[model samples]
Target chain A: AQTIHQWPVAEIKAVGSPLSLGCTIKGKSSPNLYWYWQATGGTLQQLFYSITVGQVESVVQLNLSASRPKDDQFILSTEKLLLSHSGFYLCAWSTREVFFGKGTRLTVV
Target chain B: GDKVKQSPSALSLQEGTNSALRCNFSIAATTVQWFLQNPRGSLMNLFYLVPGTKENGRLKSAFDSKESYSTLHIRDAQLEDSGTYFCAAEASSGSWQLIFGSGTQLTVMP
Candidate 1:
């Protein structure tokens, strides 16, 4: 069985602060990783996706970037956070099916 | 311009009743996935389909690539089933990225 773990279950940050979120997948190797963001009561938006380590594709530009430093590790980061950046962030891995992590709830003050 | 649109933006169902949610895709979707967002904002992947139907317990889903549509049927609705249902489509363009719908909010009443 595969499991995904996301760090800092919840975050509260200032508008100009930098932010970083991390995800790790165990029991699966060389899986496709993706980042998704969803606003309260809004649709889920694909932010970024990586097929392999060292290669990430941007699906939507929201001043956020992602990197798959390792086959099972994905990182989402921002140099400067904006008020609009507050939302629920989810990390997922896909093989034949997609599995999501618990997700991180971010609030920008 | 929503490429993936889910019908009946909101629905209210009584316990033990049945309901079906639908999604229509304007893009050439090669695969479809259904997810449930719980009240706590946790998303659980329910089904992933490749132009076919799948059933799990009281839930059943079907996808038709030719028609560019998908359907999810829930039987014996329970309170725990109250949540937002989302359908995402993967286009045939080889992007392998999911295009999600606005979601259908379902409320099961006791």
Candidate 2:
């Protein structure tokens, strides 16, 4: 069975601070990775997707970027965080069907 | 315009009753997937359909590409079924990019 793990289940950071969120998929090799963001009480928006290592595609410009440093690892980061950046961050992996992680709840103060 | 529109933004169901959720797509969707987001914000896949019907336990779903719509049927609804149900579709061929609906929040009452 494959499992997806996301780091720092929740975070509270000050605005303008750097942020880095990580996700890793175990038991699956070369799977497609994606990052989705959901604002409070809003529908989800796709931020980025990576089909292979070292190549990432941006879906919507949300002042964030994603990188697939390894085949099973995908990272979401930004140089500075904004007040509007606070929301739920989800990491998903797909082969035939898509699967999402528990997600990280971000609170920017 | 909303590419994917879900009906009945909210619903209240009585236990043991049956209900159906629907999604209409304005985009050219090739596949559809249904998901349930629990109160804790964790999304669980309920169904993946390719212009056909699928049944699992008391839940059944059907997708019609020709009609550009999909429906999810829940039979013998339980309290645990209370959640925000979302239907997503792949807008393009083999894009793998899922466009989600606004969702239907279902509250099952005893």
Candidate 3:
């Protein structure tokens, strides 16, 4: 079975602080990785997606960037956090069917 | 305007009853996925469809790509079924990203 893990289950940061979130997938190789953000009581929005290591595509311009440093690892980070950046961030992998991780809850102060 | 729109925005059902959720897409969606977002903020993928119908336990989902619509039917609703249901569509003309609907908040009473 495949499993997805996200780090720092929750975080509270101040505006202008740098932020980094990580995700790792096990039991699956060369899977498509994606980042999605969902606000409280709102719909999800695709942030970024990577088909392979070293190549990530931006789906929305939220002033955030993602990188696939390794086949099983994906990183989402920003130089500075924004108030609007506070939300639930989910990491997912897919090969036809998509599965999501536990996700990270970010609160910007 | 919303690309993917879900109807009834909210619903309340009694235990052992059945209910259905619907999604309408304005884009040319090639695939549809149904998810249940729990109160704790985790999205559980329920179904992924490609212009067809699929059933898993008490849940059944159908996607009609030609009509750009999808439906999710829940049978014997239970307390644990209380959550927000979301439907996402992958458009044929865009990147392989899912455009999600606003979601339907469901409350299954015991």
Candidate 4:
């Protein structure tokens, strides 16, 4: 069985603070990875996606970025956090069926 | 223009009844997929669709490539079926980026 893990399940950071959220996928190799952000009571929005190591594409520019440093690791980061960036962050991977992680709740105050 | 459009943004259905959700695509899609996001915030894979129809238990789905549309039918609705349903599609000629619908919030009433 495959599983995805996300860290810092819930976070509250001050405005303009640096942010980093991590994700790891187990039991899969070279799978397509994706990052999504859902605003409070808003629809799910695609943030970024990576096809392989060291490759990522931005789907929605929200002053955020993603990095695929390894086959099973994905990181979403930003240098300056904005109030609008607060939301639920989800990391997903697809081999044949798309699988999602538990998600991280970010609150910027 | 939105490549993927979902209907009935929200629905309230009585238990033991049946209802259907739809997704219309403006781009040429090669494959379609459905997902369920439960209240607990876990997104579960429902179906990975091909151009035709498929049935699993009380759920069924259909995708038409030429017409660029897909529909999800839920039968024998139960309280556990209440959640937000989403449909996504991958374009045949464009980037592998899968586009998702705004989602349909379904609530089952007793």
Which candidate comes out best when scored by DockQ? 3
- Tens digits of per-residue lDDT, candidate 2, A1-109, equal 9999999899999999999999999999999999999998778888888989999999999899899999999999999999999999999999868999999999999
Q: lDDT tens digits, residues B1-110, model 3?
A: 99999987999999999999999999999989999999988889899898999999999999998888999999999999999999999887336688999999999988
Flag regions of model 2 displaced more than 4 Å: none
Residue range A1-109, candidate 3, lDDT tens digits: 8999999899999999999999999999999999999998899999999999999999999999999999999999999999999999999999887789999999999
Give candidate 4's error at residue B18 in angstroms. Answer: 0.6
DockQ of 3: 0.82
Q: Model 1: per-residue lDDT, tens digit, B39-110?
A: 778889899999999999999999999988999999999999999999999977468589899999999999
Candidate 4: where is the Cα deviation over 4 Å? Answer: none
Higher-DockQ candidate of 2 and 3: 3
Measured with DockQ on alpha carbons, how good is candidate 1?
0.78
**How much native contact recovery, as a fraction, does model 3 achieve?**
0.77
Q: What Cα-based lDDT does every candidate model obtain?
A: 0.93, 0.94, 0.94, 0.91
Worst 10 residues of 2 chain B by lDDT: B90-99
Estimate, for each residue in B1-110, the C-alpha lDDT of model 2 and write its tens digit.
99999988999999999999999999999989999998778999999888999999999999999999999999999999999999999888768589999999999999
Better of 1 and 4 by TM-score: 1
Which ranges of candidate 3 are over 4 A from the true structure? Answer: none
Residue clash pairs of candidate 4: none
Per-prediction DockQ comes to: 0.78, 0.77, 0.82, 0.66
Between which residue pairs do clashes occur in model 2? Answer: none
Two-chain DockQ for model 2? 0.77
lDDT for position B12 in model 4: 97
